[model samples]
Target: MRTEISADKVKGDFLEKVEELSGQSIWACYQCGCCSSGCPVAEEMDLLPNQVIRYVQLGLEEELLSSKTIWLCASCFQCFSRCPRGIDISKIMDALRQMAMEGGVDRFGPVEISPSELAKAPQQVLVTVVRKLSA
Candidate 1:
């Protein structure tokens, strides 16, 4: 289970976008894995919270957007509070969700909600579903 990370492919603008949109510097993350350690759901994530920051730092926009990790985030803010660098992992998750939405839902993983079910769901629930499932 080896993963190859190409720093050469890191997009400057993508990194900038994460910082600019989220108002949090991705470079601030030192990859100490504190965020991941604090994440209660990290065990269920395809990529840990710390890994998400690494993806942003490396400008791996496509990889970040395609990952199920961002969608699995509980947004409990536990990781954010525990981050030694004070990085807002939750905000980064939101930024990733926004990017996914901008790319269109198809760029994300498969979703199995029927139109009728979605229509019948509450507004906030629908919004959360779309936000999380969009990626």
Candidate 2:
């Protein structure tokens, strides 16, 4: 989707808090798109890693929280390693996901899963979902 955000429209304070919580500075990102280019799942995301950083910088909390990218992220740190500024983009995604869950998005949805279905899920997926939702 095409979008526009002016500097005055950005929320400086929220950006500061994200940095404080994640130990990664939003200001450090230069919008170089390196993070997005390097992200393995970037093509599958509604918003690329670089765009997510911009949303965080602009304090688009609701948009960021609702994005599919937050769930699609593998947290493999490929973007972090590729970043020229060394920003931990995965951590930021994690933080946004935590916020989303806290904002009432169900991790497993409203429908109750059968015990057999739950048992069939991969152990790693279960652990990751639990960790992200609990954060």
Candidate 3:
């Protein structure tokens, strides 16, 4: 993806909002790759944990917010456990998910699925999806 980064973008409100919501210093991450290395679902993510943090740091709001990595996070805390900076990546992911949902970016909902598919879906999976994806 070709993104144009500027000083204004790096100092934008989105970065402040993310820091406020997640309560983590976005600049604290040194990109040691520990978080990504320990992430069990890293392969499935569009952006790894460290890459997500870098995106936030660079104020790539559109790309970061639209990423599937935020929603795909399992909140297993594996990334946090491995982070040398003690940054909880799961919390950041949660904040990103919240921001995305608030912005009306629905990843999953009744409209996206067929009735037959919804009917065949596991009850637990449906419940989890509703809890996570619903605004």
Best by lDDT: 3
User: In angstroms, how far off is 95's CA in candidate 1?
Assistant: 0.4
Q: Can you rank all candidates by TM-score, best first?
A: 3, 2, 1
Q: What TM-score would candidate 2 get against the native?
A: 0.80
TM-score of each: 0.76, 0.80, 0.85
Q: All models: lDDT? A: 0.80, 0.79, 0.88
- Residues 1-135, model 2: lDDT tens digits: 445576754844667767776888887888999988888998799999999998888877667777889888888999999898989998898778766777777655413556786879888767666676554
Q: What is the descending lDDT order? A: 3, 1, 2
Across residues 1-135, which tens digit of lDDT does each residue of candidate 1 receive?
Answer: 334567565746888888877899888888899888878998889888988988787778788888888778868999888888888989998888888878884433325667787678788876766656554
Cα displacement (Å) at residue 55, model 2: 1.5
**Which pairs of residues have clashing backbones in candidate 2?**
none
Output the better candidate (2/3) by lDDT.
3
In Å, residue 87's CA in model 1 sits off its true spot by 0.7
Q: Could you tell which candidate, 2 or 3, scores higher by TM-score?
A: 3
Better of 1 and 3 by TM-score: 3
Candidate 2 residues lying further than 4 Å off, grouped into runs, are 1-9, 109-117, 120-122, 133-135
Model 3 ranges with Cα > 4 A deviation:
110-126
